[model samples]
Target: MTDATIKTAAMLAIGDELLSGRTKDKNIGHLAEVLTMAGIDLKQVRIVGDEEEAIVEALDALRERYDYVFTSGGIGPTHDDITADAVSKAFGVPCLHDPDAMGLLSEMYQRRDMEFTDARQRMARMPQGSRHIANPVSTAPGFVIGNVYVMAGVPQVFQAMLDTVVATLPAGTRILSRSLPCPFGEGDIGTLLGAVQKAHPETSIGSYPHFDGKRFSTELVVRGRDARALDAAAHDVAAMIEALTMEREGAKSKDLGTGELA
Candidate 1:
């Protein structure tokens, strides 16, 4: 992978159900992982309701701020499905029945012996100058207009569309990472970890704490585009953990010798 400038992206998840907790979101995590692997930095994620105004405002802001904006949900057959309209308004483009989308959906419906009803026809609509994002799992397609990619809300379809969409995006410098299991908790290594992070400005060090049913431990993850810098930072983290462990053991030994509880 090339160590070029990092591409940036943002996600706009639309639907009232998400905000209301009626529907759990599975797309955000998948998108984040995919984007990170593709070298696109997923900088921000915004969840908006089915309201067109909210969608439009958020869409405009995200599209303007990021290199790419991905939107999910609201492009369905239901009356409340208004993502196409919101996208069109956001870009000042006309929302129309895309012939390519209509043809694809029509053929799929014909194959299933289902009528291409007006409700189903709603899936065929998209903003002008938008490109189709082929859906392998579902007949209905997603769309890309400008830097914004509008995809389905369903997990399977969203993932399928993402496969196609990610291939078309320019890959940046892939971030490399290493994880070291630390026997110490965050409180035990916070100060030293921060010092290591500051020393290695090229790498990002993160400590995630976990409980093993007995005590809290930490996992130190070092991430960077440069391999050497990442390794150096990870080594520092390991050394820090070792030193802390030794210090704690020595304190316990001293307390035991003095007949004090450690």
Candidate 2:
């Protein structure tokens, strides 16, 4: 990948059920991982209710602030699914049922021998002057209006639409990562980790704690685009863990079993 700085992306998850904890939003995590791999930086994520005003406000703010804005949810065949209309209003465009989308929806319904109701045809609505993002798994296609790409709420359909969109974005610097498990707990090495993070602000350091038998251990992950910088930070973190472990062993006058730090 090129060294060019990637354009940032922001996500808006629109649904009342998400905020109410009735539904867990899974699009954010999948989008983040897929966008990262495609060299697009996913910067901010927001969860908003199904209110049209809230959706419009969020769309306006995010579209202006980031290079791209992706919205998931509120696109289903239900009365509450008004994301397309809200986005159209946000861009001062008319929301109309696209003839092409309707054709696809009609074919899909006919294939299953299901009656197409107004609610099902509601999925054909697209924002004015927008391009469709095809969904391979399901019939309701996503649309890209300006910098905002609106997709479905269902996990499978959302992922398929994302695959279609990601291929068209510009490539950016790819991130690399390495991790080492510290036999000591996070509490024991939190200070040193903080210092290391301060020294290498470009790199991200994450500490995850786990139990090994009755003892607590932590896995330290170091990530960065620059290989040298990431390796240096990883070395420093490893040294810090080794020194801490040695100090603990010396104080207790006992040997801790070693599986070798990564």
Candidate 3:
């Protein structure tokens, strides 16, 4: 088994529409799930407006802080789509039209019998010395510079680009997660939950509350990369819940409480 180490990642979602609520940001959730499965911890996520300075500052900061940085959006064929330029400026590199990207764009234009104007040609511009990320859906390719991997804003396009990039990345020890649904409200299990977290520092515990009208229920999840650690934590948590239920039963028997044991 490979030595377990936390690999941190940062995400930058660049677009003005997201901030204005014109577009609901769905990319971050998908990216977070994907990164988690690959054992990469998503440390920070930022949604910045379509401003060059703001984007550059965020890019520089995240790239320095995290092991890997991913930016989505602002790679479209529009004047406001200036992610490529901002990225280049952040790294102090010149943005130039990539020959391979140009060739791909030319082929796409020829196939569609469309004229490739300067505006359309702008899609080919990538940071110098950056490798092109294959775009399976659209002609405009994403690029990788150092630890930063730039991807498209469109969901379908971004997903396809991720498939290409993720394969080549180093895989850390994957996290394992297990959830148990209990017929107890969060308020009923609050103290026991805190004790579980305190006991297992390696495992992350989450409580999701649900109401079924007649009763309240919660799904508790324990997550960690180490199987033994996760199992031990889960056992202790279950035991604590059982003990709480027994105490509640005994109290109700004495007319001190009326709620039934979970």
What total of clashing residue pairs does each candidate reach? 0, 0, 0
Stretches off by above 4 angstroms in model 3 are: 1-4, 211-216, 245-262
The TM-scores, one per candidate, come to 0.94, 0.89, 0.90
The TM-score leader among the candidates is 1
1 against 2, candidate with superior lDDT: 1
Q: What is the TM-score (0 to 1) of candidate 1? A: 0.94
lDDT tens digits, residue span 95-127, model 2: 999899999999999999999899999999989
lDDT of 1 by residue, 56-122 (tens): 9999899998899999999999999999999999999999999989999999999999999999999
How much lDDT does each candidate structure score?
0.92, 0.89, 0.90
- The regions of model 2 sitting more than 4 angstroms off are 1-4, 209-216, 254-262
Best by lDDT: 1
* Predicted structure 3: lDDT: 0.90
Once superposed on the true structure, which residue ranges of model 1 sit more than 4 Å away at CA?
A: 1-4, 211-215, 257-262
Tens-digit lDDT track for model 3 on 1-262? Answer: 2233777899999999999999998889999999989988898999999999999999999999998999999988799999999999998999999999999999999999999889889899989999999998987899999899999999999899998888888897888998877768999999879988999998999999998877788999999988999999999878877887788778778975555556
